[model samples]
Target: MLLLTAVACLLNTVVAAGGLQSCLHTRLSPASTLVSPSSAEYPNATVSNNLSWQYFASAVVFVGSAEDAAIAVKCAAASKIPVTPRGGRHSYASFGSGGRNGSFVVDVTRLQSFSYDPKTTYATVGAGFRLGNLALALDAHGRATPHGTCTFVGIGGHATCGGYGLTSRLWGLLVDQIVRVTAVTAAGDVVEASPSKHSDLLWAISGAAPSFAVVLSFTIRTYPQPASTSYFDFDFGNFSDTPSLAVKALLAFQSFAATSAPPELGTQFTVGRSAGGTLGLRLSGVYYGVETAIPTVIQPLLDAIPFSPISNTSKLQGYMASVAFLGGDDPVNTTGRVESPNTAYEKSIIVPTSAPLSEETWTKFVEFAFNTPVPPGISSYYWQIDAFGGSYRGKRTAMAAFPSDANAFGGRDGLLLMQHGTYSDTSGSYPAGGHAFANSFAGTITETVRTEGKKIEAYQCYVDPLLSADEAHALYFGHEKTHKLKALKHKWDPARVFDYPHAF
Candidate 1:
């Protein structure tokens, strides 16, 4: 709430209101929630997760339906201002605000319509619903979908941008479950995209939708409720105290995940220091079967770390309960804050099989993580490493978006995805070397992996704010996919009407 107020003060700068209001009034419903810079809701409309990206949008439109979204797009195009569809407003670089000032913001929070068809077992939901709300809706019918832990992240961006959840290894990504979608193209025309229809558009949208289209709703293929899980966790004491021991021990865990780990197992290890200055490691996961298997499943990791765990925790719970726990929230409270303002910079490392770290590189990575000199004003930092690509990479089927080729999610081959970052003490005050600190850590791993004679990549969801547009395009999509996206971009948005910073 304080950050929201601070953001309001920072963005209260008055700017000229270009003729977007008149154009929108002609097409949008009279009762539509539209706010310009002069409106009281302007501050609320402009707030976001990452305070580092505080660009002012020319106008914010809380669209009602697909038709209304199209109208907003038409207005932005007519006014010659870039239009960006903001779902959760969680874009690390704030591309949701067009990533620049004076852009038109199409706020999708009002399109909260949802319906589940038990006959097809498919759920049709508007893009506005947050992840928690969508989860509750699905759980009502004894059904669920694979998605990330963040309760407040919007379904629109999360689904399209390769969503990974704790059960992703068993099921698949949110994009993998997308049977079809309704979207507004750059030309202000609405269309549907699925495997069987407008597939190229579907492929272009699934990985990087903002570049080509503004999605209105998604019709997803749903799965039945999964079996209860045995939650397993072991905490290794302070990292700075025993870096060589803990880091080396953790490598064995990664080895097991890449090879012998079962599809029913999912895990992530977080490396961060506590407020008491205790740099520690917490390796936690859930086994989606009997509790008996949990011991055998985690024995290798336990053996690797010779020292006794400072704390060990294991519990059996339903899927939703596990979700709330993993997200650091209580069982009853699922829908978290829609906007969480913070000063942070994150960089991702997508470890492909072709470029896995060797023993030598792994040791070097440990050295860097433990001994590297952090830049100034870096109040706190951490890294989250998730085991990816069990069923995620291997699962292939006739289901619409199941096959690797069905959509544009490019990191299928990655064995592990590491999202690491540093944050500032104050809400909007960025640390002096936040980007450099984050980049150096990610860069060390990336360079070391490349030196081992293979390829390494990054996850687009944890966007790097410092990279150039070209660098981001190459890192996220590589040459071939970037070429494909650009071709589609030209076809659908030749005028670049819906352009934003680092969109493609």
Candidate 2:
């Protein structure tokens, strides 16, 4: 959300004091306070889930409630400062911190409130609550909702940007679960957007929220926990070294997922190099059904692949156990967040079921993944594709069983969401070719598809900071959606107060 200042933010100490005092003067709730650049807490306030854009914020107001959020926004506007709403602080491009200095951040992570209604099966979660905590809290009542695997991701941005959970195939994207949202608009109005109220605003906030408002809370629908699941893991060690075999296996997996995979299955394919530079591919997923049925479903697909798995296994797990297993850790932290921030660059591509990745695209994917050599100053790199598989043979719904016009989320027809990322060895620094290295995959895909008279998209959740505003908006949301969003943006934020690069 970096404002287009070609140079860095001006560091006039007066600007900080003026903005901080303006909000504090409003008498924020007892628990709310503003942290200035001079404060000892400034460093922590400027950080989110990523280290790449740990820019110096002009001030951060840790809002305790929706009222506090409104006050922070109004105060920032009065002081002529930009507002960046900080939730779990996990904007890969650091939109939570504006990706630049002089950002007046409304830190909402302190407003951790949760309440559930057993009678209605609805959960009203404060925007501050992390996904992990939400999972645990809902599990206590034997209820759950769709969300990302990363526990620390805030429900606000996650839902706003098409949150894709492991259970999304069975349920739907997190945005589909959002029945209501309470927010502070550009004009400092405390409002609630829902199906029955502010309906248009509700549609915008459901996906492109940052372009319009600072969402304070979300009321979402929840479901009963899964009775049982079979967590399957398949390893094809160093298989990518042989492009032909890897391509064949990858195509087999993709074919099974796109054609015959059931709604209960959630699978991801990952190809990366080992410590010794051995390229390999791994396939893992969760089948939200009886454990014994695993072989009935996955076994045939495994047999179809040209490259045999080095080892394959499946384990029975209940709802919470399976979530923890796939997430790499139990979402447990009593005092603070669970984090290991990285100096990373990210890119994404959304593969639709309508046109599937063609032979040219798959061949290019194999080439980029295996034949490409690691560049200098890159600590780690890998690309993983999550197939949002469902019953998609034209008889049922699309991704997550939602219609294309369901909300602002543009990937409703996606069969796969591909993430290309590279981590720098040193914090806050990226190699010269780092951007190009990760961009190559999606870049090549776009080129191949265009020649065939088709267009492609990238997953908005995995934000690519390098793309121009127009390009990002167009790819993430199509020309039609972009125009619609821009019109809505003009209506809601005519002054462009809630401004960000690539935000409509």
Candidate 3:
């Protein structure tokens, strides 16, 4: 407790210096105390409630107060140790774990405060703001940001690492809409970065931002959202046998992508676990305007899926209602401040060369994701495959410090696919074997894609740092672009204090 108090004192000084003294003080928990793994509550408090063992053993604990987060960086700099900014602890890999050896970690859960500028149509969100809380706040104001599908995703990492959501088609990637970000550099100096201000730093923070620096807060542009949004789900049961059906439906979805999509209309494909080892496909959409148009514009999709004459609801429900339908109840606990463990998993965010869902590639995906168990728990999930291109193309708008490609951002049309293996153990704990299983699963799937001679663009957030520099480079924006990013990292983080694996 004495150590906790001392740390809190130092934290107050650091955050105060950064012009956040009052805000930080107000957000700190009245009864909260910083606990370490060495503390009695360490075991339970250090790991997320749902998934344990997703972090490494050497993580240092910072109990409470956003001030503690600032102090954590200062301590690390003085000691010449590294630190990772942690909030929500939902990252699948150990990217949030600064290093294997004990490193100072700025657990920023206590800093979860948000202030809105209704006049400016902007939201100044603290680094610790949780997605759900953000959602509630915005919904009350009849405005919203394109946050994650899961409510618990932290806005700090989500925005920094390229936050995506159903509204991406209308607004843009979460990072794309961010106007400014407050980040603590390796030197422990707080800097406000944006496209116009610190152009290069802003360019590198998103998609492939270096983690060595701690992101403090982000000010994002928000939209005058509808009073209520509606979500419609069409589930295609018995997916393995529905290849032809899948092909036809996917093609129609691609057509939707090519056609001018209404700013109010956002659509995606989700294939997930079903009864009897069968694959399930859902052509889902969220429309900001009249829920009535859902059936009309989505005719192509409805024609292909196996919707029955009488059983089909072809329904439209409210935004909050849709949240329940999408399994928003799978609570993402924001209470714990510990980091997620360093475990391996098979993951990829690939944008294919084309928008059409090729039958051949779909078949290959099915086989790789289900038939092969190289990494036992790997599963295939796609958010916006065919429909991604229509909304996210051809406009160079102001974005935050996160980088965006002119072609990829709004100039060209494309889709983002997140294929991954979820780590789960029979014993209810992710053991060492679980890590090995995930790695093998990822390798086997990627090899198959290579063998098929298909080239796909990769999203850097889900990538593991273990891949070779060349491999990682190619997986990112390719060798040439990767080189530029590496050079930028060196230029910005000369001392490499914010170092993390594969952080180009």
Candidate 4:
């Protein structure tokens, strides 16, 4: 039949390309679909958000189920080829695409399925489901889960790697909401990890998942839709002209967030080039309450700013509509949620409240950002500082399955999470133009923060491929936690089947 012929052709192609006939015949399942490097689907499967990462996998397996995933792993292990799981293909460093040549990649987007229980308020989600689709599904049931703003990101990767979002302060992180996880181990066994069963596995995957297993699904806690949601957008003018004022305003906001901001309020401060070519600062956020409460919570920061905002907009709407407003999308159709791939580099650092943002540091940031040359329409850059440590403080005790103190994530106790990013289009005249600028900007920021304060740390979720092995280990997981994760890796994936850059 046609299926049989296609399988025959695929087997021949694999043998010709990878030269793993014995392992393929012994371990690969007939139902598992393999896309050879010469196939047209290969390009699509290999495309990633960060185009800078050039991944050349021996084969890309379109896994249809958890069993298929296990088969792919077994085949890769038997063949002595490294294997990595790919969901949304959005890893900043292409960690999802095997991360090295001659490796095998298992793409799990075909495993999309989810169910929500109204009585128990728990949602079981497939690993391959994107955040946007999940949001639409949850909205139909009048429920919501704390997830990142980018709807196209896969939950499998995001949830396991510390899912930070607008409502993080109100409901805690997405990983913290996970009650159970189902994953395929390196030994080709499907295991369910939770608080009581596979407790250590659960703790390890809550943040450092890539080094342990290929997560297939998750059972997460959900919350009822908020009665009303409010949003505010404030443009605080160009930072180049008013460096001192901009830095003062930013520090004031951070100070307030550390001491006064309620759990229901979440804010993000950004410094980037406006559409008109001016470097400016913007403050935008959401309040999970009535419109009347927005002013009371945000007034202090607004009053602290030395200059009046150029533009201010506030609205009270439905929960979904509020999400759209925060994400700058069309409320009714969500048309703004489109994805256009490009080459980019990013780095992050966590600043604790004890080591506040100093004026000298802000001046240096302003100088570097303004001085950086961005190719007119081909490249761009930005610096973002997300408020971190409010309700997150309760995770130490609230999340019994994966306590904040012992997990691999490093930003739980930090006051602000700072991210520096530079992006360039591959089709541009100078494809690699953004690298030098991004490196300089990121290095300056990291050096400034570390020199100014001793308590600063880096976020693991923003995995920077440039980090050394020792630096990555120390930044992603501290000395003690790294050792614990390594021991768990030894027990679960002794052969190191699930490995990538910066992996445990």
Error of 4 at 424 (Å): 1.3
When 2 and 4 are scored with TM-score, the better candidate is: 2
Tens-digit lDDT string for candidate 2 (1-504): 365443234444455547567656666878788887778988777876667656777788888877778888877777767677778788899888876766778888877788999889999998988888888889889999988888778887898998887788878889888889899999989998888989989999888988889998999999999899889889888764488777787787778777677777788888776333778788898998988788878877888887778898888989888777766753533236457778888888887777787877788878877667777878777778887744555544335467667688887768778888888888877787777777775666878888888768888889987788899988788887888899999898887767666677
**What lDDT, from 0 to 1, does candidate 4 have?**
0.75
TM-scores, all models, native as reference:
0.92, 0.94, 0.77, 0.89
| Residue ranges of candidate 1 with Cα displaced over 4 Å | 1-17, 274-276, 330-339, 390-402
The residue-by-residue lDDT of candidate 1 on 26-142, one tens digit each, is: 678864678888899999888778987788888899988788899989888876778898898877888788788878888887778889999999999999888878888898898
Cα RMSD (Å) between model 3 and the true structure? Answer: 7.7
In terms of lDDT, the poorest run of 10 residues in model 1 is: 392-401
> Which residue runs of candidate 3 sit more than 4 Å off their true CA positions?
1-34, 48-53, 57-68, 99-101, 209-212, 274-276, 304-327, 330-346, 353-358, 367-386, 391-403, 406-413, 423-454, 461-470
Q: Pick the candidate with the highest TM-score.
A: 2
Candidates 2 and 4 compared by lDDT, better number:
2
Model 3, 178-254: lDDT tens digits are 67777777666778887678766666665454443667677888887665666766665555655555555555555
| Candidate 3: residue 171 lDDT (0-100) | 70
Candidate 4, residues 1-504, lDDT tens digits: the string is: 999998896675466446543455455666667886787888776767677786778878877788878877777777667778887788887888867665678887777778998888999988878887778878889999888777678888888778888777777788888889899888988899988999899889888888888888989999988999888889877657776777687778777767767777778888887324788788888888989998888898888877888889888899987666555542323223446666777788777655766777766776776676575444567778878764324332122123555455656666777887766645423345555666677666567877865655777667778787678888766677788888998998888978877776
